[model samples]
Structure formats: C-alpha cells, structure tokens
Target: MNELLEVLRHQAAHFGPELARTAFQRGLAVTKKDGTRQPIPITATPVILEAAEVRRRCELAARLSSAALKMAEAVLGGNSQEVLLGGLSPLERAIAERTWRQVSRLATTRVDFFVGAGQQPRALEVNTTIPAMQGYSDIAARVFLEVVARHFRYPERALASLLTLNGSNALALYRALLDGYAAERPGQMPETIALLCRRHDAQISELQYLAERFREFGADADVVHPEDVSGDDAFIAHGKTYQMVYRHLFVRRLEENPSPWIEDFFGTVPGRKAVFLNPPTSQVEEKVTFALLSQALATPELAEGAQLTPEELEAIRVSVPWTRRFRHGPTGGPMGESLEDLVATVAAEPQRFVLKRSWDYGGKAVFIGRSVGTVPYNERAQALYGAPLPWAELCERAVADPTGGGYVVQELVETSPEPHVLCTETGVLPTSLYVDYSAYASVGLARQPAWGGVCRGSMAEIVNIVGGGGVIPLITAEVAHKLLMAWKAL
Candidate 1:
C-alpha cells in the first residue's frame, strides 16, 4: 500500500509545476449544486482492497450481468427483432446492433468480475455510440508515459509513439489527420487544423491548450468560433489552407445555435474537411441505456448477440434487485405489491428503501422517505393518490419535463463502512468512496473483440481527476487491459 501510494504521488508530481498549477485552478472550480465551492482534497495514501476481496467483487459483477441479461431476454423473448430492429433505419440498425454486441461483450468480459457482498456491478448507462473520454483517458496515459520517458530513462522505447497512434487527444487527433493527408498527397502535410468552438471562456482556455500543443508538434492550430468563418468556405484568413477541421464545441450547444451560414460555408467547399469528436448522435447519451437495459423491451437476441449469458444475467438481477418486480428488498423483505405495491412496501418500511426516478441522473429527484419521516410520506402519498397525475403519472411527467427524467425505485445500496483517503495539500485525508460505473467503447477491427470498457472508483475521485484535479486517475488502461485479456481467453 505504501509503495503504491508513493507511485501515485510521484506520477501526480511529474506533470510539472505548470500542470500542477492548472490542476489547482481547475480544482477551485469544483462547485456543488447549492453553490458551494470546495477545494479538492489531495492525498498520498493508498486505499487498498485485499486481493481476495477484489476477486469476490469481480465474481459478483459477473453474476449481476447474468441476471440483467436474463431479465432482458425474458422481456424481449427469443428474438430481438422488435427491440433491436424497431424504429431504426438500416444503417442505424446496423450501428445499434454493433453497439449492442460490443456492450454485451463488455458486460460479460468486464462487468462480471467486480461483484462482492452480493453487490454486482450494474450498468449505470450504456454509451454505445460516440463515447466521450476516450481522448481524455488517452491523454492521461500519454502524460504518464511522457513523464516516465523523460525522467526515468525508461528503456528509451517507443511506447509513447505507439500510444499516440491510437489516442484521440486534440493534438494526437490533429496529427493523425495531417498524417492521413500526407499519405494521400505524398509531399504535403496540412498547414493547419482549425478548432471550432463556442465563445465561452472555458472553451477558449481548452482551445488554447490545444493550440499550444499543436504548435509544439510543428502544426498550426487556431481557435475560431463558428461565426468567425465566412461564406460556403469558412476558410481561415491565411494563404495556407486548412488540412483538417477539429470540432471542440459542444454539439448540442452548436446545434441549438446553428450557424447555418458556417455550415453552408463548410458544406460548399471541396477537399476542406471536418471531424466531429462528438457528433449529433450524442443525443443518445441523454437516454439512460441502463434503465433501458432493465426494461422488458431489451430482448434476448440482443443479449445473445452482445455475448451475454444466463449466469451473468442472473447476477445482474440479483445485484440490482429493484429490476425485478418479484425481488426482495435489502433487508430480506418483500419488494412492492405490483411495483405499485412497491410504493406501499416503501411506505411501510420507509427506512429500507428510497424512491428513485426511473431515469434519474446526477442523483436528482431522489426522495428518501425515511429522511422526510412518516407524516410527510402520508401527505405525499395522499397527494399522489388524489392528484390528477398520480404518483407514477407525476414521475412520468417529471421525466418528460426534461429535469426529473423519470425515476427508478431502488433500495439504497448498503455500502461497507470504510474510511476513504482523500489527497490534500497536507497529505491524505479520510473520505468515503461513492462508487459509480462507467462504460467505454473503442473502434476498429482490433477493438472489435472488446466492445467497451468498465471502470469503478470513488465518485469524488472520478470527478476530481476528470475536472483536471488529478485526484484518483481513472482505471481505464487497467480495465481495458483486463477486458482485452478476457476476450482473448474467450
């Protein structure tokens, strides 16, 4: 544990003073919904789970996947013709099927191994199409590789070069486009890669980092808002032509503020190109695929094609007991009467369960009946029964309203009491781990075997590191390697 902690600290320090300062600045930006800002706690202590416990967790994860698959199959029947094929164009259906297969395989290969204490890893959501953070993870790994190379004289191998070829970081991606251009044209490498972004300060800062990095690699990169570019040729001002366009803007935001003129400008030009890091298909992210997975609509054909099995499906159902109408509560008590019966069951034993919206995100619209006490429950229940929109109806309205996003009734997961270590300026501070799961996907024939990846960590750590605080680095490479090995074994 001490050795691992030292490694983590060393890794964090290796990014240099500038990166550290940037991380601190970003750390200050951490704010809660209540408008409270909190500094990130940086610790130099290892939070170690015993190897035996880790194995148990992995086993439980497998069992949960089995359960979820079974439930999905029972709902979909033997064929996924309706669930998989419905409301999709041929191309869309093909893509969806591919994604489904990848996610299924990923679930079987990765998710099944993280279970413990009857706690199976349930899918938080499935991001089958246009998954974000691939670039981010790649960048992090690259940063680590760079540090190791510079200081340790680590064999002088070409690991960084190999890794760079596969990564999608802003710099690496632009370089790839240039390399492709050079391949086609023989003598020429594109002079510049234009980054399109909104006029936000944070976006500007990100683009600046990208621009600086691009310059470091002998390429000119500039930040241009959509409005700045002109005509059906949103060409840059310089005599040099843009070899590639990299979109850094938020897709939804850009769509909301459609630069039709800019679109026309780009569309009209020949040989001028653009690549969207996250294209329009990102709307899929808004739909909670995890909730969809638990639904009867997700068929067995879908599960089988995705590489799910009976055992994995059973495990999922057991871990996420709320999915089944018949499953019992956390305290070995019966669940709901009809799921409507669940309301009554929850009402009777408020302490044992909480009402979760079907498609809740970021922990909103989560009503803990025990927290509110019995009197409020009676009032809310009465209102639920009496209102034009009954409780279920109200939940549906909330989900549809774009804020609540429906809800799922879930028994609170009883996490083991463990002291968490938070990295602080002074050193390690004790904290609690709020575990969540993330699913990732990779492309190409090489990536086909393992459709996606799963990573588990304390929620605080994930948020901190993702927000640039460099807290607990995500286990992307570790998890990816594990899944890849599993796929090879299969």
Candidate 2:
C-alpha cells in the first residue's frame, strides 16, 4: 500500500494533465443551484480495500435496507408508526406507503461508514434516497487507472486488470430499474425512462451522466425536472409518456411546487401510470431508521418491531455504532453509564457523541462535540443553535421533540486521517485529510452486482462531498495487489 502511494506520487507529472483533461471531457462535474459549474473534487489517490470489506459493507447496507424494506412492508401491510418514528411526515407517510405498495422493492442506496480505532467498521448513516456517486466512481477510478496505466506504459487491454469500478453503479441501478419495471408490468420492458429531479439540482451532472448511461444500456432515458412533467393516466415529459420514472428529487422539493401534474405523477405512484425505480423512501432513509436498528438490538420492543434475524442482529451489533433517538429522559450510555436524562448527560459530556437531524443531507445538520472550539465547527454550531451555546447548552438544544422525531445521538467513531493527493483541474497537491468509506447496495434486485465502495475526505470530522470535501476512488485489494506487482516488475 505504501509502495503504491509512493509510486503514484512519484509519477504525478506524467498523469496529472491527462487526468485534468479526462475530467472535463467526460463531464465529471456537479452544479450549484445557481448553475455555477465546478469540477467534482477528484483526488488522484484511490483507497484500496479488500473485496470482502466492500462486500460486507454493501451487504450490511442491504440488510439495513432490508430492515427498512421490512419496515416499509410492515407499513404497506398496515403498521405506519415505524416510518413515522423514522421521521416521515404524515403526508410523507401516505406517499411512502402508496409508493411502497406499488414499487415493492428498494432499487439502490448508499451506506456511509467509518473505520475507527482497531480497524473496527462503524455504520454511520444510510443514504437510501438519492444514494449517488456511482457514475462519479467509474469516472474517477477508471480515469485515474487509465491515465496512470498509460503513464506506466501498460497496454490497452491491461487497463481493466488494475482496478474494478464494481460493474459501475449506473449499471447496477439500471439492472434494478429493469427488474422493478418487470415486477410492476410483468413481461413488459419500458421503452423510455425519466430520471426526475428539480431543475438545477446540485447533482445535475451525475443525473445527466446516469441518464446517458441508461440510454447506452438500452433504455431511452432523460433527466427531467418536475415543471416539465405532465400526465393524466401516465407520466409525460417533453410530450412523451415514460413507462418508468426514477425520482431523484425529494418530496419537499415536490411539495414546493405541488403542481397538478407533479401531484398526479408522484402522488399516484406504483400505479398504471409508471413504475417508480426508487419509491418514496424517506421513511427508510432517516438516521432514526439506523438508530432504531441500533436500538432494536438491545430494546425488545423495537427488536420485535424491526423483525431482524439473528444474523442481521449480530452484524448490527458489530458494525452499527451505539445510537438512539436523542431526547430528554432516562437513557444508557455507550460505556453502560446510566443517566436520568440523555440530553443532560450529553450536555455534560459532549465529547463522546455526535448529533444529527433525523432527516438531513450534505452534513449540514451534523454537530460534533469534540470540535466545539474550532472556527468551522463553531460557525456551523452557531448557525444551528442560534448562537453557539456553551457545550451544555448546545447539548440541551441538540435534543429533539420526541413526539415529532427529530435528532439522533451516536457514539463518536473517530476515523483516522491518512495521506492523499487532492486532484483538481488546476493541479494536484499532497495533503492529509480525514476520509470515510461509503458502500452502495441495491435491495430487491434479483442479482447483486459487484458494488465497490466510494470514499470522501475532508479537513473536518464531518466528511461530505457537498461540504467541499473530495471523492477518492476505491480500488479493491486484488487490483492493488496486481498493480503493485506490475509496478515493481516495471
């Protein structure tokens, strides 16, 4: 591993320019809402991991997704409280159940994880909604591999032997969509599909990338915004009725406009109108969902509700960190300490935990106690708490309304920082950044694909791409082994 990093760094000049050119040519960029285009942060450094590690994380994501799936099934089968506790609004609940009844499967999702001390893997959050970056992973790992392989003078055929992009997230999602379409409209294949999102969404580039790939994979797919969506008995975008729809937009975004067509299109899901690739999943996508998964392992009431098997429970016990819905009143700590009020305990000893809104994205709602004094943390804390409270006040404020289900407290899992070279269009620079691994999983797909992990690194504890951290492509250990041997031979 050390040898690979050193060799790549030593040979930067030979491959850096091609890497910059490849990024632009392939459209590997994300947009701001204002439509300001920026290169998706690329780090030439690709984190290599054992294939088993990748498989475990994906399987764990699938298990929890299955837990969410069972929870969704329970809702479809008539129990709605679990999703409500997972933070879906009543209207959101109605939408989720309706969609779940129709779609009946989870197509794609991403699980975020951190490898803490002793190399213990801790599951942090599940990104069931818009679990992105499959395309970006392909572009990064494949591009970096191709460019560096060229620098190493490897022949064209040898390009693929170095690293695997896990059959590409786009293809995995494409296959899942096909299976969903078949399940919904058995014996029929959709001629056209729509990747729906709000116009100028931050992930526009990636959506476009996926749309094109879907088309390449044989589904005539288009990236469409809600405003353009129209239909009565079917989904009509750009005057064509798409038999399948992959909604990349959130319900809140849909509610913002609430046009008649948007209502008909989504509000009437899993129907004759079209097959939803990703059903309304905010129910299973919440941090509380994982908290419940964590809580279920210990609390029999939740355990019965979750219906996880012994195998699933064991995995959660080992991989899912200690977490609970953060609220006032009696609670137990990670070290078995008892407390009358979790809020007060957290306020008193803020260093041991992290707080996050049950439903949030882009790391905007994450607050780490150990980072209290730092400007980045302090500024974010001030914005969230209406003025940075003393640590105790911050803790008190972190607790959410139990009735509505708002916050989750997690035992902090400190991920180690390692050396990485940040790759950008301008140039590449060596730096040490805190990075975490994310594995993508598809629930309800008939055949599972080889899904490699995606990585993000940042200067702060909260590592998110939208927070301005960069993406590090992951190379499987097998590929790294081969690449290393080939490098030394050269």
Candidate 3:
C-alpha cells in the first residue's frame, strides 16, 4: 500500500466520521479558494527516491549547516541583529546582550530541526520564535493513516496510535536538535503553551486541535487573540480576567496589523512570548528582501561568527553580473576591479546588466536595458537621473512599492531543463525546472547585533520567480554549518 494513502486511511479510522468530515470540508474550502474544481490538489507525480541523490542532498545539508553556523556566530557577534531581528536598535553590545537572553531562554525550551526532501534538506527557516506546522503535519499523518486503515486492517496500529507515534517522533527530533542547548539550561523545558492568533472562527478548529494535543502532553494550553489578553490576565482566553499574561503568542494571521489595543497588550505582558510560527523577519517571502539583500548596500552576515573570507566574498561578487539601470558609477568611468568595484562597473556594462532600484522587490520597476531599446533606456535614464530617487523613494514608486523594502542586483543563474510535474484542475501538467530556492536558517549563536542588515518582505516574489521559469535554489549551506560548528566549539 502507498505510505501516504495508508496514513490517510488510519487517520480516518481514528478520527471517525465527524472529524474526517470537517477535514473534508476544510479541504473543499481550500480548493474553492484556489479556484479549483477538485476538492484536493492531489499529487499524481511519483516521488522516486534515488539513494545517490539522497546521500548527496544529506551531505550538502550537513556542510551548509556547518558553514551557516560559523557565519551566524560572526554576524550574531557583530551587529547582524538590526537585519535579522525586526524590533529594537540599541548599541551592538546591548542588542547582543538582549538577544543572548532571548536565545538562552528559547534554547532551553525549543527544539530546532529542518525538514525537506532527499539528503539535501533545504534550509528552512528557524522555528525558534513560533514553531508552527507541527500540528498540521500531525493532522496530515493521521489523515493518511485513516486512508490506509480503511482499505487494510492488518495490524494493531490504529490511526490515532500512528498519529501519536508520528507526533512523538517529531517531538523526539525537536528534542535531539536542542539537546545541546537543553543541557546548558537544566529546568527550562516548555511546560505551558498559549495559542495566539486573531479572533476568527476559521482559526478555531486548528487552535482547538493544538489545544487537544497540548493537553495530551500534560501541558496547559489556551487559544486567544492579542486583544483579549491584558497585562494582568493569567491566561489567554476570550472572556477572562486573570493572573499572568500568556507565555507565548502563536500568530496565525498572515496580515499582521497590530491595533493600538493589541500593541498595548503585548507591550504590557511580562513573560517571554514567541510571536508566531513564521515571524515577520522572514522577508525572503517578499521579493523586496531578495533585491535588497543582493545590493551593494546590503551586507548579509553569512553566519554568526564567521566572515566570508576575501576569496568567498569575491566569488559572491563574481556571481552577480553588472547592470546599468541602478548603476552607481560615472557613465564613462572605468569598471571596478573587485565586487565592491562592480557597483560602479554596472553603469559601464549597460547592455550586459539591468538597472534596478536598490529597494525594488520582484521584477517590478526593473529596467532590463537589453529587453528595452536604447530610446526607452535614454528616456527612463533621464527621469531617474533628473529626480535621482533615493532608495526609499525608489521603493515607494515601484509596483506596490517593492522598492521601499530593499534591493539587490542578481546575476541570473542558469536554470536546469529537466521536466517536472504540476497539478491542475484538468490534470497533471508536465513542467520544466522552474522552482527557486527560498532558504531559511536557524542558527545557535551568542548574540544579536544592534545595527546591521536584515531582509523583510514576503516570499511571493520567490514563488512568482519560480513560476516564471527561474529554477535552481541557492543556499549558503556551507556558511550555516560553519556557524553551527563554531558555536558548538565555543
């Protein structure tokens, strides 16, 4: 039997008709939202596992993890906090102190792990502030188990038991990841959890599911919105006036518009709080972050403690081709000799490179001189130079103000030609390689920097880019691993 199908069968058996019906309804709703005729976006494509590929991916992940850890320490040790952490901008040392405090506290209770296909587990972002999707995975596993149990009842493993086992496995993975940190902080295991989200009926089901799971683990849990909780409230509940504030706030709402009341509540609450499963700092979701991170002005701290050697930095410079639209040098000046020099070199290589606003995200407001004629380039150049929009201004003018976020000049990477599968209402579509890698990182480092570069935006650009024929995911796996090892050594 298919592993996934089997899991779904077991899930149905354990959850019974009512829960399964609810899940079916939810799936239907999601399909409607996606404007699809089918209730589920089933994957008809076969996932063939090649042992060699798996080993390669795994090796890459390990190497990347090491490199990332080293860079993390350097960046963390310096002033990368201004970029990575969203709020607060004190001196570097002070920021470092506060960040260390936060990290230490979290290290004790949180378990970190990365999940992806093959050996090269794509670098997903850290689950430190708000670890989400665990419950989702659990539910998915249960659903699969149910599907399997309905067709074949061969063993003692019921859907519920399988789900329990899966959940336990996930938790075990988390614990192993955090074993080092937990050993340092003896008694800070996470005991109670508070599910923070917008007060919406749609979210109730998921929150309720989590609450049940937390209860199963013998931990007290509750679901509440930020507005419902006050400084004096002991628990986060809709209709309650109690003791201490909720320990953690799991943000479920995608659009975060903190009203005055909500802000005041969060500010007044004393205990440590995790913002959401995916914090706002993950700007890679936003194309603007990529543009900004790629710019000369943007300095990505490769890791916590490791600095890119001159050679590595040079390699990065070489990777990015020059363009004229957002060039920084004089029109007729000689090109630069180093990566830093290319900032000026771009102006000279008008045909080879595209000029973009330093703050623009996605392909918006990007002037591909090669695509446009000389006449158009001259006209746009006049407007751009006449006004000479600052980075902030350029960002505001870009489509939906993609430039307002940040910018970078990326030398396009060659994409693979292999065909892949995509699901549609009609049937499965055979597509070519077009997926872009949006890598995430969770590093164990000492501190957060006071003033440095960090990218903030949505991952929509990456998805769009991938949809638009851009393939090949780029990750700093070597950098990540180095940072991890360095921290471990320390």
Clash number by candidate, in order: 43, 0, 85
- Alpha-carbon error at 373 in model 1, in Å? 8.9
Among these predictions, the greatest lDDT belongs to 2
Worst 10 residues of 3 by lDDT: 448-457
For model 3, what is the alpha-carbon lDDT of residue 407?
Answer: 31
Note the Cα lDDT for every prediction shown: 0.40, 0.74, 0.33
TM-score of each: 0.50, 0.92, 0.47
TM-score of 1: 0.50
Question: How would you encode candidate 1's per-residue C-alpha lDDT over 228-288 as one tens digit per residue?
Answer: 7653343653443455565554433445677665544323212334322222222133222
Name the TM-score of candidate 3. Answer: 0.47
Instruction: State the TM-score for model 2.
Output: 0.92
Off by over 4 Å in 3: 1-40, 44-101, 104-132, 137-142, 145-191, 201-209, 233-235, 239-405, 410-490
Candidate with more favorable, higher TM-score: 1 or 2: 2
Poorest stretch of ten by lDDT in candidate 1: 442-451
- Model 1 has how many clashing residue pairs? 43
Best by TM-score: 2
Q: Which segments of model 1 are wrong by more than 4 Å?
A: 1-3, 6-121, 127-195, 201-223, 231-248, 251-258, 261-273, 296-428, 435-439, 443-470, 474-490
Model 2 gets an lDDT of 0.74
